[model samples]
Target: MKINPKFFIGLGLLLIIGYFLQDLVLSDSQYIIGVKKKRQEKDDSFRRVNGSPLSQAQRDTFKNLPYYAPDRAYRLDAQYQGFTLRDTLRMATTGPQPEAYLRWGQATFILNKQEYKLTLYRRAFGTDTTLFIPFADRTNGLATYGGGRYLDAAVPAPDDTEITLDFNHAYNPYCAYNNSFVCPLPPAENRLNVEIPAGEKAFHE
Candidate 1:
């Protein structure tokens, strides 16, 4: 799916800012991403020793798998109520609504008479209600290595008017691309029956 011009521009601006202030970020891979990267490196090393070499799939192991792949795309344009935020490149929306929460951000729902659950986590920012939602799907290991995609969205502010949950910016968690990254698994409440073809796809690696 094509990204909106405003969103792209915003991303470019953010990247530029990040680039300009490289030292501002501490040197540390995210927990899940860090673990994933290490795993990928180990796999690559093993492949090298086997003389098979890392293929594109393996190489892609270092790339965070997004949902906006060739097959699917998600749009970040949903407002439940009293929330005004933009879904950025790290948002992953829930699927199969009416599902009960088994736990925090984890629950099950009925889909086509069948039941499925999902695990949703967020890397929140700021002291306010804003959050960074980055997630991967169950397809990550199979069709997409089970590493879902990232859908960055603006969280509803306290007593806010609206919120924007765009799936168009869904991306893969950092762990999808690299094993050195530590990423959160779908909490059983985020799983869906329908293969959400709105975000990044499986990493080739």
Candidate 2:
């Protein structure tokens, strides 16, 4: 049977639309998958490397690290409030010595109608590109680590006021795993009163 030219054109258009629709649906799934993959890789590295914070005994019996269920809502867009006079903050660590970090700025975001702010920081020395955020939520000492979790974000552009905070990517400090390591304690300003049910949970012994 001879097919009409219009039929072929219509079929092509339908195929194109379907392709885009599938892409849109898969984009979110793909992003979540990437997050999970990165976490798994990090866990694998800790277990495999001898220099990792995890003791050999812990690694010997290690199966998998605990994590909260990934929720899209936990990934939020935030407004960056830059500080004019950057303060030098001396952060207490698990060890006797404290690490110095620059008080870069704060990022404000609203969750459940509650406006929350997280103080961002950078290493006092070297070319700092990472925006470090150590935060404690209500989940601490319960579902998550008591000392709190960390979320690293890219430094926002000088003129850019918007940034993304993915709490689902939050991770515990090395001190949570072993006492031999020194991890910076989250500043009081970074603590959240609300329960953050996403990201790494309390480590199993």
Candidate 3:
């Protein structure tokens, strides 16, 4: 479901408290390893407001992806279903140094600074944000991910000002990451007008 940024902050503090209270979180070796590695990614995640760990499937997806290149960035343009949109993507300078804007998918974004509806989809458990719908055009499937491009804006930020429409960070959904992942499909509203040339390139596998 769409877990807001507040939930992540509180959970993060608990993880810290739990770290000191090792007796609480040490359920297995894997969990411990996860905590340590995630700690390194805190500054980026916490600052940008995307404070969640990558799902196991997501991590696996990256393993199959090509190595990231810092020199590259994607510029997305949208114009499908009669709406035109564009974004000059910035790298996901957060938790994970993702070639794309990678996270567990829990960030809220305001489309074109719209005040009424914030999210494009409704989340589960009354969260109204867990679902995502992204569309890809001919170039994406052929040149990028065969399934098209993936993008999600579920993240936290110091303030809303830090957030912007960055096409450079657009990415493929987890389903693109891995076949097992059931990613939220982009709805009609989230479609773009032009081509997005940032974030993760087409899948290798």
Please give the RMSD of candidate 3 to the true structure: 18.5
Which scores greater on TM-score, model 1 or model 3?
A: 1
RMSD of each candidate relative to the true structure: 15.7, 4.0, 18.5
Cα lDDT for residue 136, model 3?
A: 55
lDDT tens per residue, model 2, 1-205 = 9999999999999999999999977987987898889888988888886667888898988887899878888999999988889999999877898899999888999999999999999999878679999999999999998998999999988888988999999999999999888899888899899998998999988
Per-residue lDDT over 136-160 for candidate 3, one digit per residue giving the tens place of the 0 to 100 score: 5445665567555554443332243
lDDT, model 3, position 34: 48
Q: Quick one: ranking by TM-score, best first?
A: 2, 1, 3
Descending-lDDT candidate ranking: 2, 1, 3
Global Cα lDDT for candidate 3:
0.41
Model 1 quality (TM-score): 0.41
Quote each prediction's TM-score: 0.41, 0.86, 0.37
User: lDDT per prediction?
Assistant: 0.44, 0.90, 0.41
Instruction: Flag regions of model 1 displaced more than 4 Å.
Output: 1-73, 76-130, 134-142, 160-162
For candidate 1, the per-residue lDDT at 17 reads 93
User: Which candidate has the highest TM-score of all?
Assistant: 2
- Relative to the true structure, candidate 3 reaches a TM of 0.37
Better of 1 and 3 by lDDT: 1
